[model samples]
Target: MLSDFLHEYFLKLSIIVAVFGGAFLGIGIGLVMRAGAALDGIEVLALYTLKRTSFTITEIILGINIIIFSFAALKFGIETSLYSVLTYFAATKTIDYVVEGIQAYTGVTIISAKSEEIKHQLVNNLGRGITVYKGERGFLPGKFDVSADCDIIYTVVMRLEMRKLKNLIYEIDSEAFVFANTIKEASGGIIKSRVKH
Candidate 1:
């Protein structure tokens, strides 16, 4: 009934329907998987294959999807298959966002002479906890024998807060060497800001 209605009214807008349908399907699947449930046999197969193979879950799923779509193209038409592929792509990305979370986390590392001030600012202004490692700097070809003690500052921040953190650090010390890595998952410590009553 739903398909008949959509086909009658949305034949001209099939692309939009396909993309949105795929996205909603992905969101549902992601939620189900997060709740420790499986909705598709392919996903179970992928999980089983994950333990025995070097392929990532995403790669495994994509490979399976390709095979399925190839058969679909042979049975249906190229246009239909292409639309299905687009839907699959949209669904895959939506699943990633749903599973990983909308707010992505990044691990940032800063090396600077003004580590103390940067640390203070990050803690007070950004409301972020940081870890400091004592390390030596100034190992150059000409100054191989010379070195100085320094503090390496590391912190985890949301992707949205990355720009603010970088700007704050650079504002304090323009030459501060700052780098960040995408964190797949993070827990513990002061990752969440304390709520005030």
Candidate 2:
């Protein structure tokens, strides 16, 4: 009977431990970020600006990277500077993912000509929903191309699903323009329930 009781509650116990562990990790990350933002008072200013305006955390990160890379390029060389750019991009994405939450949801926006096919795959195969925005798609800075109407598909998905979705998209339209960002919070929709036994 005791063995049966333990067996029955094992999953529950494990889940509890996992949740607590994640919470502690989150707290630790928060403290580290606070410390990071304290450096030279610039981070604090950036954080303040980020909190107030519509600017995303990524813009600030990329801005910092631009400065760092410029300095690195002068001090080191083009090779190290290029490597730093890649590293900075990865770090910024990671920070955005962490800052969003443990779940690390991502919002995907695809401006693909293969909208119907992509929609079908997402809805039927992946069981995901998407929002379509119909708008003009061209305004060139260099190339004088004529504007054309397009449908922009947007979907919110877990980070795990992001790669799969992107692959499916690329398989359909190789020239598709896709962008993704970590979502802070999501609720009340096709996003499946989190509660599990």
Candidate 3:
């Protein structure tokens, strides 16, 4: 009876370890990406090779994972391959979530013909501070007269505000041009905009 109890206890402990170990490995991989570094392991070899070769990272990772899975099946049988499959899925999904979160909070740049109006709306209406850059813009076949003074607006807003801000701009000028991308890290000069939550 005591031996059976011990056997069950060890089995439960082993299962717990396997599940959490997989999750921990996934978290560690996420941290490396956050740090703008690669996770130093067999899984990241594809990432490194792709960077060096200037090939697509997604394609390389997919190819390498398939090869690894096949090798695991041939050498260690299906059980080992199965465990690796679980770990690979968990790590990739977790890393993607973290990377997306990082991107959402990055700064935003706005290019619009109604630069002054947008600037006023952002600062006074939205209560968010912004910077302006002088520039010129022209569109269409043969109409290339530049603005005497155009403003390029830059601001950092929370991820949640992105949709609302875009809608606001569209309401004002449906023809407005806008683009946004993720930034890894930022500092100095109030990155957080003051918004009424």
Which numbered prediction scores highest in lDDT against the true structure? 1
Name the TM-score of candidate 3: 0.56
Which digits, one per residue and each the tens of the lDDT, describe model 3 over residues 4-65? 99989986775565567766776776677667777556547766685588544434554577
Backbone clashes for every candidate come to 0, 0, 0
Over the stretch 1-197, how does candidate 1's per-residue lDDT look in tens digits?
Answer: 99998877776688888899889978987787667677788788877897899765556766788789989998898888888887777777787777778787999999999999998998888888899999988866897778889999999998888888889998999999999987877989988654343
How many Å off is the CA of 86 in candidate 3?
Answer: 9.8
Off by over 4 Å in 2: 1-101, 139-145, 193-197
Q: Model 2, 1-197: lDDT tens per residue? A: 99999977985665555455544543544455745544435356658778887776656756876787899899899756765565555555555545665566788999877788888887777877778899777756776486788888888888887788888999999998999986767886777423333
Instruction: State candidate 1's TM-score.
Output: 0.71
- Error of model 2, residue 185, in angstroms: 1.5
Cand. 2 TM to true fold: 0.49
Cα lDDT of all candidates, in order? Answer: 0.83, 0.71, 0.69
Clashing pairs in 3: none
TM-score of each: 0.71, 0.49, 0.56
Worst 10 residues of 2 by lDDT: 21-30
Superposed by TM-score, candidate 2 places the C-alpha of residue 186 at a distance from the truth, in angstroms, of 1.4
Best by TM-score: 1
lDDT of 2 at 75: 83
